[model samples]
Target: MSAPAPHGPAFSGRVGWGSRPAVLVVDLCRAYTEPDGPFALPDPGPAVEATSALVEAARASGRPVVWTAVRYAAGLADGGLFVRKVPALAAFAEDAPGDWGALTLEPGPGEPVVVKQYASAFSGTSLAATLHAAGVDTVVVAGVSTSGCVRATATDALTAGFRPQVVRQACADRSATLHDTNLADLDAKYADVVDLPEALAHL
Candidate 1:
């Protein structure tokens, strides 16, 4: 078995914050982060607005802004039973929020908009390499489905050698209780859970 990380969200263990921090918006696509859309989660409107502000701050500091969108090929062929099981996910039309309108923020000249299929942004995606190439050692994470995509991406970020800070107030899910519960877990185990003000305080 792999040894537990010597340091986690609870303590940095003397590893100071990174100089290059990026903003990673996970699964903010129209499918997940909307109210009346296919595969919509919950009240993701305010969360998206908060994320937009965070992106602005990251840009002001000249940090890379990475937005992750979820897209899978038609049929259960590309996504297997995962797609077959969630029939609503099949309705993600290219013209919908699945295209990520609310999640759209101008990437600085060299920023990235990563496309993904699964919950974890790092899964079958170039997120790790992209962040590394940008010299980003810390990621400010925000997104939809607090119990799903956000959690998955946060875990992957930590595994791939980046400090991931989950913006609790800037993330949402289908259930308010689920949102609060997942945020608690993320704070205790997966990632550092901080609200928008706390995140902006550090920035």
Candidate 2:
């Protein structure tokens, strides 16, 4: 038997990296990175290392870097239905012990950190305006849970009129299947999924 056809011809259009790009690190928090944490992935090291390289390359190129974290008020008053749906999010509550929501890759001076309650980094946040103010025409997306926050943020970035480039090696998920599936979807419809070297070159 032959394999199925790819998602091209219909969703083949590519929005290549623009002239001005900013690395958007989404939800690379301790909750997902720490092995003992509730939301830890099977293997977070590769994604973390790739994302760190992307961040470093962006900074060295003098490009802007934005970080996003999921934080909710005590009792999840700010998380809305998302918290109720995924109780694991309690790890990010303001009063949660050990600051589990803290970013694994700390933001540097002058770097903007956007705290959100939902999956998408651009949802209910100043991320669009921040990117606009920085003259960023493209978003180099990285971070945890490729099937969740990373996919959402990449879609929203495209919706907000910015080119979205999802670094394939810089995003992780609970499983390899989940990560690969979502990256394929994002590349077909919303973002251009590229490798770390390609992303670094763009930066």
Candidate 3:
């Protein structure tokens, strides 16, 4: 068989799954998943279903399962740059209906829920410390807006000395193009982007 022509410059490196792993579910809230919910995506069904599976695998393995949500203060004063860049962020303000921020996953007792005003779960949040305290050396990332929160969290995970593995089917975005593009980029340079089955096997 003939080798395919090369496309872009090779961006090489892999941060394989580490000994201790944690599942980080980012913003799979009603806002992004429910059709009538604020900040709703056209279709988050697949990602929601896939993430539920990841959560189950994590639980079965007894790994830490952490969740992240975006919530701005009553007036959006704390949102700052992020809100200004994406006005739709106002949907996450506290003044909005409670269901908007409701998580798709039914978090069990003692599961930590990290709240942030930015894309990265680690930004202005104790996520890294939480992971470190739990002795987690690898972060299994899954959630909404593949081009945004998932990507940001995965990138920051790498910077924080944790191997990030993004489950492709478990991360979503309003735009398929954006989702696929960012996943490709992440797989190339930042994280290991694997399918749902592979992610479960990793767990």
Candidate 4:
């Protein structure tokens, strides 16, 4: 890790990849990618393209790929507290039309899709069990909003006994400050913040 964040204790260590791994694509739905969508980030192109390449690489390597989306019913009853905190979540309503919450990545036939109501993909979802059942000890995580779902998923992945290797180029946020800050924290504590090529080679 670089020098300690100006205000926090120094953190420096690497949790190397395990023998078995899976790719966890977090919240790369149209709601976060489409230019005109309610939750769209500023210029999601780089993250989208990088993640697409990583997805293809993982598939070629026969690694399991898990995708996630934030989808709730029309009433927002399923969203609960999360919806209240970020009213923008209403854009992800499952009943919404015209790709408001469509998956940007083309999930393969056998790839499992996890629908989550919270920031962490493992929260209120069966992601940990699915990864465990598949013997996935390391998770190659990528996708949108590095400060939100990507960061949360990485933290939860660590808590669930999986190594989270976050690909920097494959994750993004509307603000560079949020993206970099979260990446620094994740690398310093919860996970390994790696480059796209490094993660692809591991796959």
Candidate 5:
């Protein structure tokens, strides 16, 4: 079998930072960070630290910081088909034990928390409107499961007319392969996959 052709030269357009940018911390809850949580990642320390730095930088610069977390009604009545697809989402149930859905990086004063039941933060949520109201033209993304929520949010951010800058070191997945491949694809098409320092500078 031959190797697949490279994605380069064609999808290589950069949607760099815009005049107004917001830092979006997606689903950095205990469910993914804690060892005993149902959806725990193998190593979330580095990603968490990187994300924390981004948050601090955004706050220091007076840039908006928005957070998203999955939360379902009792019995997951609001979870819809997504819960069936990923049963582990039960960890985010409103009444789940150990506060598994609690954000590991707590939002500061005046930061909005967007509760969602799906992967894409913009799906059925007011994220777009929130960003628009704040005059945010670019979204600096940092969070977990690179192949899932991070990818979904970045794609949707582009569709909603926001420049998506994904912080490479501020995201984690079940494995390194998933993290690297998804970032590569996102950088090629949907976003600019940047390092923590670049993201901080943008803030």
Candidate 6:
């Protein structure tokens, strides 16, 4: 079920390079993007491609391009609700082949990588301070599990006083229904939702 768009304040968009926006790519790791393989969530290929574009744009514009990965130590003991949500996630060992396997994007030069244990990147992490330090008042997010991590982060971003701009086509969940529905819900309430081209135009 695709979420229905809400009728509210029309957002023309207040985020762009002019405002020192940062692009946060969340969980594009193998644990969620592989096709129909283990730990896979829907098709994240398009999201990856779109995210890559955003990364390049952010880099070109001299803004922060941050990436986040969800990882536990090496055992379930380090994982709490994460262990309960999908016990299989514990398999993301140091470099062992688990779900979609390990994430590939290594932080290059200035890119800040945040490792988190929960759905919301803002939870128990220095993400807020980092964004503040970087003078980023708006966030452009793209990543996995639209209904979970993406939604949680967007909500947190809003509450934290940063404008959250979500790329509708740059995030995915395990189900098309879930991805679209969550996008609709986030669009109606929490974040600014727009397709890639429109987002780029506004930016």
Better of 3 and 6 by lDDT: 3
lDDT of 3 by residue, 161-199 (tens): 999999999988889899999998898889998888988
Candidate 6: tens digits of C-alpha lDDT, residues 50-77? 8887777777778788888876765555
Estimate the TM-score for candidate 5: 0.96
Ranking under lDDT, best-scoring first?
Answer: 5, 2, 4, 3, 6, 1
> Model 3 scores what on Cα lDDT?
0.89
lDDT comparison, 1 vs 2, better candidate:
2
User: Which portions of model 4 miss their true places by more than 4 Å?
Assistant: 1-10
TM-score of 4: 0.93
TM-score on alpha carbons, each prediction: 0.82, 0.96, 0.94, 0.93, 0.96, 0.85
Query: Residue 196's C-alpha lDDT in candidate 6?
Result: 88
lDDT of 2: 0.92
Q: List the residue pairs that clash in candidate 3.
A: none
Alpha-carbon deviation at 154 in model 4, angstroms: 0.3
The candidate that wins on lDDT is: 5
Model 6 TM-score relative to the real fold = 0.85
Alpha-carbon runs more than 4 Å astray in model 3: 1-9
lDDT for 121 (candidate 1): 92
lDDT of 1 by residue, 113-142 (tens): 887767789999888988898788888898
lDDT of 6 at 19: 69
What does candidate 1 score on TM? Answer: 0.82
In model 5, where do residues sit more than 4 Å from their true spots? 1-6
lDDT of 3 at 191: 95
Model 4 lDDT per residue over 1-203, tens place? 68766436556477899998899999898887888888778989999999999889989999999999888987787989888999888877766666677898789999999999899999989999999999999999999789898999999999999999999999999899999999988898999999998998889
Candidate 5 residue 3 Cα shift, in angstroms, is 16
- lDDT (Cα, tens digit) per residue for candidate 2, span 1-203: 96655974688579997899999999998888999888988899999999999999999999999999888889888888998899899889888898898889889999989999999999999999999988999999999889999999999999999999999999999999999999999988999999999999889
Runs off by more than 4 Å, candidate 6: 1-18, 93-101, 104-106
- Model 4, position 119, has a per-residue lDDT of 94
